[model samples]
Structures are given as structure tokens and as C-alpha cells.
Target: MRRFLIIAGLSLAALFGLAAPSFATVSEPDDDPLIDPAPCVNAATDGDADNVIAVCTPLIDQEKTGKPERVKALLARAAAFDRKQQFDRALGDYDTALMLDATKPDGFNARGELRRRQGNRPGALADFAAAVKRDPQHQAARANYKSLALELERLGAQLAVKNKPSFDCKQAKRPVQKAICADPELADLDREIDAAHQAKLRHAAAGTVSRRALLRAQDAYLAERNAAFGRSTDELRAAMKARLRQLRGGKAD
Candidate 1:
């Protein structure tokens, strides 16, 4: 009976040893605290700026945290700073996030928008372009690029014509030309008259009697202006206005 009890005790010990390994395996830590990203993500999504900064900063500061988790923390804090109108801090975060991983379009797009608000158009355009290149179907980036490009084009055209006379100011040897170049209102009037006259010439058939008559009228007007400019500047301006009206099919007077 004592030998039977000893055998039973040995069998129980062997069974317990076999189960111990399984228990250890089950009890092992599933997630490492150093690299855990839940707190940063939650704070960014649900918390305000102050909360996000407080919660995410620790994760970002952790050296053991993976690049992906670090980027998330940085982006969250950046957005929080942006909401508080701390643009410089927000930019620093965005720069760090992009430097960590340039593949994400969201980072580029967000940075582009911030740069645009700061009036850094060139920087904004480059960022938007990078975002679009990474993800062609990125709607917001595409829209921003197209809208800014059109605005710049329109501005360029306006700037091209601004305060410019019909005749070149550099070649203004005549008193009338110098006067037109000197006064913005006179320059605008000169451009209008020249544009109207050119339009009439384009509409009139070449080598026809009407075209010949139009040319003659233009020559007469130029001769009269050249002869009258030094005498009465007001008269020259009035004559130019009247000529413009006539070219537009208005009354000759």
C-alpha cells in the first residue's frame, strides 16, 4: 500500500510539470507597454488639444516606440496645436511625421493646407503635389492644386496688363506717348482705344473699300493727334475717347 501511494504521488508530479509550461505560455504578456499605441490614438481622436498633447507626448518620447506609433502621436499632437492656433508647433510636428514616413498622403495634404493658410503658396503647392503623386485619387489635394494653379494664372494675366499703355513706355519719344505712359487713367484709355481699333480692323474684310476707308480714318486721327498734342492735352485725350467710341460703332462726335 505504501508503494502504491508513492507511484500515485510520482504520477501527479509528472502531470503537474506538463501543465506548468502551458500555464506560462498563456500568462505571457501579449502587448509590450513601451510600444503600445492605444493611448496616443485615443487621445488624438477623442481629446482636446491639451489632452492630446499630454497623452501623446509620452508615447512620442518613448525610444522603444515603433516608427508608426511615433508618427501617430506626433500627428495627433500637431492637430491639437493647430486647433489652438499654434502654427509653428504644428508645422514642427508635421515635418517630423513626414520625415519618419513620407509615404502617407494625409501628412502631406495637411501640411500643405497649413502652409497655404500661412501664405506660403510655393511651399503649399509643393506639398500638395507630393500628396497627389503619392495618391492620385486624393480628392482634396487635387482640388487644392487645381484651384491655386488657376488663381495664380489669373493673377499673372492681370499683372501683365496692369498700368501698361498701348505703346511701349521705353520708346515714348513723343510728348503724347510720354503723357499716356505717365498717367494710369490715360494708359488705360489708350489700351482701350487700341484694342477697339484692332478689333474693327480684324472684323473689316482686307483689301475692301471699307478697309481702305478705315485705314484712312485711322491715319487722319493719328495725324490730328500728333499735330494737336503740345497745344491742348485735354483736346488730345477727348479726341482719343471719341475715336474709341466711333470704333465701337458709336456716334462720331
Candidate 2:
């Protein structure tokens, strides 16, 4: 049963297109009091899982430890648990750390990755989004969010292949429109992008410059698509995904 559970967990990670956790540590200042004062800090950051857990557990248990110190220890121990595939324990610690300090992008990113590996796509998505919101420059969170969004889109497309395209095929005037209508996958993508765009508009404040910019950008994207002749299905899909990312407040490809 233990082996089976391990295999099941690994299989779920594969299905989500998630790689194993890289266990990367953010660098702290050499003379920083946080690092220098904490006995478990180095072991937590760089040691093996056993040592990390052993050293961090004490720090976490200390009632007098500062909130920041305790949160760091929790994250370290959580990462150790993650490496050991003790996902429940890892998630608990991550939750505690985040509760103590929701501003930590790394905590959210780590928890998001763990949730993704455990096949909790919605949870992963929420965590990743939170991480990015907390720190837009967080590369890991951005990458994870983009990848998961694309995967989710692909899954939705697969499930709704039988649905009609956003545009009418019977009145299709352009070759690109005709092509999109002919291919179920491309049609699904068209519908998805359209829905996503409309949703973004619905949420945008009226008369705002951001809303106007979005409209202009979307119009430009459409104009470019209409002008491009003989673009492949793959090209169209890529364009749609880029637009979707932009709509989701991510940097365009």
C-alpha cells in the first residue's frame, strides 16, 4: 500500500505536467540577524531533509521564537516533508506559515507546487495566483501559473470539443475562421478565448484607462489574426494562449 501510494502520487504529478520540487533556497544576507541568530537556519536552508526536519522542529516548537523565525522554520520543515513525500505534513506546515505571514511569496509558491504535485489543481492555482499577487516579480509563481493555466485550458478544450466555435462557421468569410471551424480543437480554443476575454471585460471598471487599453489591445490582436493568412492551428492556439495570459494580468508572450 505504501508503494502504491507513492506511485499514485507520482502519477498525479506526471498528469499535471509538474516536475519534482527543485528545493531552491533564496539567499539571505550573510550577516543578517535572522540567519546568524537562528541555529536551524543553515540546516533548514541547505541540509538534507533529515537534518532540516531535526533542526527546524525544535525552532518551531519554541514558544518564545519570533513569528518570523517560527514561520521560516515551518517553511523549512515543510520543504523537508515535501522532499520526503509527506504531503499532508508539508501542507499543514505551509498553511501555518502562510497564516503567520501571507506576504511571503516563496511560501505560497512552495505550497502551490506541492498542491500541484498532489493533483489539487484549483488549490495550486489559487496559491500560485496569491504568490504572484504578493510579488509580481516572482518567477517561479509566474511560470507555474502560466503552465497550469495552459494545462487547464487544454483540459477544458478537450472536454468541450463538441461545443460550437465562438464565430459562425456558416458565415465565415476568412480562411482562418474557416480553419478554426473545421478543427474541433481550434474551435474549442476560440470559444475559450472569447469567454475569457468577455469575463475580463465584465470585471473591468467602466471608463477606466486600463479597460480602454484592454479593448484596444484585444482589437489589435484580432486585427493581426485576421490579417495573417495561412497560419497553422498551432500558431493560432499559441496566439490565443498569449492573449489569455494577458487577460489574466500576466505578461504577454
Instruction: Give the winner by TM-score.
Output: 1
Question: Roughly what TM-score does model 1 have, to 2 decimal places?
Answer: 0.58
lDDT of 2 by residue, 1-253 (tens): 9999999999998977765555779898754233332657888757689988888887787667789889999999999999998999999999999999999999999999999998999999999999999999999999999999999999897676555688888999898898888887778777867887888888889999978977888799889877874656778777777777777678553
lDDT by residue (tens digit), candidate 1, 1-253? 9999999999999999987866344565755367568877887778688999888988888888889889888888988999999999999999999999999888898999999999998899899999999999999999998887787798898678878888889988988888888878778778887787788889889999988998899889878887788745687778888888888889553
Candidate 2 backbone clash number: 0
lDDT of 1 at 65: 86
Q: How close is candidate 2 to the true structure, as a TM-score?
A: 0.51
- Residue 56 accuracy (lDDT) in model 2: 85
How close to the true structure is residue 10 of candidate 1, measured as C-alpha lDDT? 99
lDDT of each: 0.86, 0.85
Candidate 2: lDDT over CA atoms? 0.85
TM per prediction:
0.58, 0.51
Whole-model lDDT for model 1 versus the true structure? 0.86
